[model samples]
Target: MELKGIHHVSALTANAADNYSFYTEVLGMRLVKKTVNQDDTSVYHLFYADEIGNPGTDLTFFEIPRAGTTYPGVSSISATSLRVKDDNALQYWKQRFIEYKVDHDDIITVGGRKIVSFRDPEGQRLKLVSDETNNGVKGGTPWKKGPVPVENAIIGLGPSHLTVNDPDPTIKVLTEVLSFKEIDRYPSLVQGQQDVRVFSTGEGGTGAEVHLETRPDLPRERPGRGSVHHVAFRVDNEEELQYWKERLQSARLPNSGLVERYYFKSLYFREPNGILFELATDGPGFTTDEDPEHLGESLALPPYFEQDRERIEARLKPLDI
Candidate 1:
């Protein structure tokens, strides 16, 4: 049971093009892979991350047009954070937000990191925190154009914040199953009047804020457009993955049968608190399709979808890639 921390975060959106621009242009994430959602032939499953599309680096999206309106509540505060170089970069992003006309707010501390909160066009909450401690950039994928330089660009996803109706169950999963140690607790000054508990790996220093915030007064959320569909945690390989699967079953937590995505194998389930979670493998990743040099250009499909590629391609409307 060493469940590597969060793998990637996936969000549902009404428009792929807008979501793509917001992630790559506004938030400065590289679009690593572009493919249609397997279940929904017409919608795109866009993966944005550092250069090589590392797990934990990605913030993916599924474009669903007819998906309904949703509100931020206990189960759905999809605050995906990015780690920048230092306080200087934090200040730079604050100014950059003003220059780009993106709304932003002042400092908030989580797990000792100073974070500035902002929103995408779809109102998904995102933050940028300054971390000067670690410089490990193995396979780092950065946004091509932004005010922040590639070195200072968001190295990867910092955390995926889940606001739960009842934090106990989810908290148990993080601490017991996922090996995330609770680092701190704080009162949120934001609109939700929430209580935030942060969990992290390492000694809990540096850019650590894989947080869980709770709002006892808020209603629970359901899946739809502009919602975080799930948050994934990484495992080293199939051995660690099966260990987690058995642990989840022994704990009586419901889990998806291991599903192969070709690039990696994934298992999905919901914590008792209602937020969806997935355990994803870390190797044999995105380079399976095109060259590592050109990952997101053109359509890339799993072996299962190769023959049906034409039908899937036909259903999806072209976006300027």
Candidate 2:
């Protein structure tokens, strides 16, 4: 029943190429894995993160051409934060954001740590906070290439904060089934004093925060063209997956049917808060597509796409990865 922090976060983007450019060239995240959505082979499922593409470091995207508009409401989520080495790293990120011509908010203090916020090409909110100050940067991602040096690049996920209308079910799921403890709570500056509660895994050292802000004056989120698709948490293997399956059933929570995703098996569910949550197994990971040493060098696909590799490669717009 011990959950190992967030596995990865997935967002929907209008263009895979644009998302690729920003995450790689601008933000300096490594292209850890590249493949098509297994369900819809034409669409791309891209993942970007720190070195080795560790679980929490991941921020994923799905590019579907026809998916319609974005609605910002109670159900929609906001900025997902990444952890950096320290205040100096935060300054490094600020200048990088400026150099790339990406819009960013001035540095703001949250929970006694400094964080800088910015948007990806598709307007998904993201932030980089000082890792040491947050006391969550026990890990590091080595940079393969970019303006930001390895030491300054993001360490990994700080927290995937959710803005939920009802915190009870989400809290229950986190504490009861997922084995997350109520670490602490505080007032947040990002959303004007939204109650912030943090939870960390006994195993991963990565943490997730839940922010509840009463925006009675504002509208709830409508998910469409550009918004989070789902957020996944890591489970080590089939044993862990089954543990969660029984746990969810016991709690009377609904689950998306289990799916074999090549690299991992996954279970999906929506929290009462309306955010899509997934539990994905840890491995037969990127190596499934290419050897570990040569991963992300070309258009990699799951075994199912191996037969169409030639056509799939021709269809995707060429990039200088």
Candidate 3:
């Protein structure tokens, strides 16, 4: 499998407008698409990415007001990490966060790298790491119209850190099933034999890592607001996608058969630790429906939900930002 990196990371949001404001104004990301949740047409499914909505640059959200508080424990995507150009860009964001009065932690060094931990308005955990080691952009674009200048802008999604109950089976999924290379391992945060293992694909840059931080003592996490819904990895095209589906089938791990999300083709499956993983195709991108310059300006619906547009438009509130 030619896994490029993170295709996108989708999490839940209680308020749509606040989510939009935080990602667009505070984080300075582009709202590439404003579409409804295909499974349920009433709620809005928003996408925030770099300039042209590149594959690895996407961080999306599902506005679900009725969802309860997020469960902070094992079997969850505990944090979504992003990478910037260099330390100067990292410092620029640190100062920018302070100026905007955003909630964030003091800088911390982990594994000889600087990272700034923060949370969105909805309490979703996020981290920004300097891309000093990895020179590649991982396929991204700078949003000139966004709040931050191009240099200081977030390059793309770095990694989706998975908090698993047991690391062994999850490791098997990555190393055996997904063909991820076990690059390194480190001591665990908790005082025990448990530890964090880093795996990667496609040359293993910043965004390409899949960190399995085993915290066996914690309780199992349930789906709700502020929790990651799913983490998607990118594949080149249809053939690679089919190969992965066959791998999953041969492994006897259950999967969602070829789902069309309008912008991309997706396959959903849960690993041994119960974290949902998606294999998404890279082609037939966001430009299929709307023009590049005018994405996310108005509502866009899939063909099946076109007739329900009137009702869908009525239920979802307009984004103030």
Query: Which model scores highest in lDDT?
Result: 3
For model 3, the local distance difference test gives 0.85
Per-candidate TM-scores read 0.91, 0.90, 0.96
**Model 3 alpha-carbon drift over 4 Å, by segment:** 135-139, 189-193
Candidate closest to the true structure, highest TM-score: 3
> In candidate 1, what are the lDDT values of residues 64-124, reduced to their tens digit?
8887866777776467777776777787788778888887888766555688989777677
Clashing pairs in 3: 158-207
| Tens digits of per-residue lDDT for model 2, 210-295 | 34443444566877666877778878897789888888888888897678888788999887767788998877676666765665
Q: Give the TM-score of candidate 2.
A: 0.90
lDDT comparison, 2 vs 3, better candidate? 3
Clashing residue pairs in candidate 1 (N, C-alpha, C atoms within 3 angstroms): 7-56, 50-141, 51-141, 74-163
Clashes of each: 4, 7, 1
Q: Which stretches of candidate 2 lie over 4 Å from their true place?
A: 134-137, 190-194, 203-217, 310-320
The ten-residue window of minimal lDDT in model 3 covers 130-139
